[model samples]
Target chain A: MKQLKTRTEQILATMPILAWVAFAAYVIETGAVLYSYTISFVDPEAAKDVYRGLNLYRLSKINFWYYTQAISLIAGLAVSKAVVAWLVIRALTKFRLENPFTMDMVVRLEKISYAAFGTWVLAMVSNGHLAWMMKETGELQGNWISGEFIFIIALVYVMSQIFRRGVEIQTEHELTV
Target chain B: MPITVNLDVMMAKRKMSLSELSEKVDLTLANLSILKTGKAKAIRFSTLEAICRVLECQPGDLLEYDDGNKK
Candidate 1:
């Protein structure tokens, strides 16, 4: 069991790095998109050609409200993803296999769950808005609320409860000498 | 919390030092200190028996129930 736990910890140790890389990639992509949008706004003709090449010219023509909403949605998702990645990295760095049932782990699990849930809700709402916008424009919008994200949220919540129980058991065992 | 360890009292009565008791009982000083200082949550029967044998006292001599609210 101890060997298995160590192996699991070793595997999980890489997850934070993966998450951080994903977050960095998302930031870069978002920055490029924002830069493109800015150029499009500054020079519509030039931007139109650029956007057309990127297949985002239709989105560039959206109303002010929709545009702001889309930006806010993207920003929200990015911020939450970054926060989750940061927390996961911090938690994993501090994690000790010898004593895994700490309050820090519980807090980290709960925070991760909150971030996942927030991401799920934001994705669902933003996807709905996108679908509505697409219907108005006679375009098809892809589904954004993924089952994997929902599963992650649920898994984190369950893990948090499990950690809570582990903490209780550890305390009892310690008290028992 | 109402049940307190009287390990110190028993050790004192037996004129046994912590180290001596530890060596006799084949337990660590830290563990004995924990028991003496009433920090131990529970004592194993084997440990209790060992301590009792060394101190020449019963388990009751090393443990006491004091109701703070009654006082």
Candidate 2:
């Protein structure tokens, strides 16, 4: 039982790192695809003409694409952090709770997580342009429905709850130990 | 639920000081103090066992249930 517990802990500890690696790989692949599209398919002459007519920098065309990509990347990372935090917390809490770690700590942590999640949700929502860009870039290729927005809100909410519960369990363990 | 700890009694019986107990148990004096005071919310079995073994007593000797007033 002790060995099993240690092994499980080792795996859980590595989960966030693993998640980030997978996410990074996906982002790189997507960036490569977009880069190829812009370079190979977009007519440089047409872009230059448009830039000249609008008195914009010729480099601005490529720069805009890069800028938007950076924005999306940063935004995606923020959301992912919140999501991962929520997941890890939830998993750890559930594991400890079922192991009969401590109910008091788990309950208290969950309460805190609820508030944290609410704050995270608001922060994400406030950056509305990020989601809009995802839609503009064909990433969020669906209609801008209320359900979609709610889904984002729900995702953060659920994750926060998980983290809160986990914290409670950890606190309980600390106290007991 | 009210719980009580008897760390001082065990330490006294074992002829061990808090510093010695703290060193033997691989726990900080601060944490040992917390457990001794019954202010800690929980205790790990391993830690309890270590304390008991070092003190030459059972867990029951170190901990007791107090039900006069539940908090």
Least accurate 10 contiguous residues by lDDT in model 2 chain A: A48-57
For each candidate, the DockQ is 0.49, 0.46
Question: Candidate 2: lDDT of A56?
Answer: 17
**For candidate 1, lDDT tens digit of each residue in A1-177?**
889978898788887788779778667656655666567567654334332244445555655455545555665666666677777777888888778899889998898899878888888888888778777766433435664679878988999999999998887677553
Instruction: Predict model 2's lDDT versus the native.
Output: 0.58
Q: What's the true lDDT of residue A54 in model 2? A: 22
Looking at model 1, residue A96 earns an lDDT score of 82
Question: CA shift at A120, candidate 1, in angstroms?
Answer: 1.9
**Candidate 2 regions off by >4 Å?**
A1-145, B13-15, B69-71
Error of 1 at B11 (Å): 1.7
Shift of residue B53 alpha carbon in model 2, Å:
2.3
Candidate 2 per-residue lDDT, tens place, A63-86, comes to 567434443444444444445455
Candidate 2 local lDDT, B1-71, one digit each (tens):
47788999878887899999999989999889888877788888899988988888998998888888757
Q: Write the per-residue lDDT of candidate 1 for residues B1-71, one digit (tens) a residue.
A: 88999888887887889999999999988888878887787889999999889899998988899889874
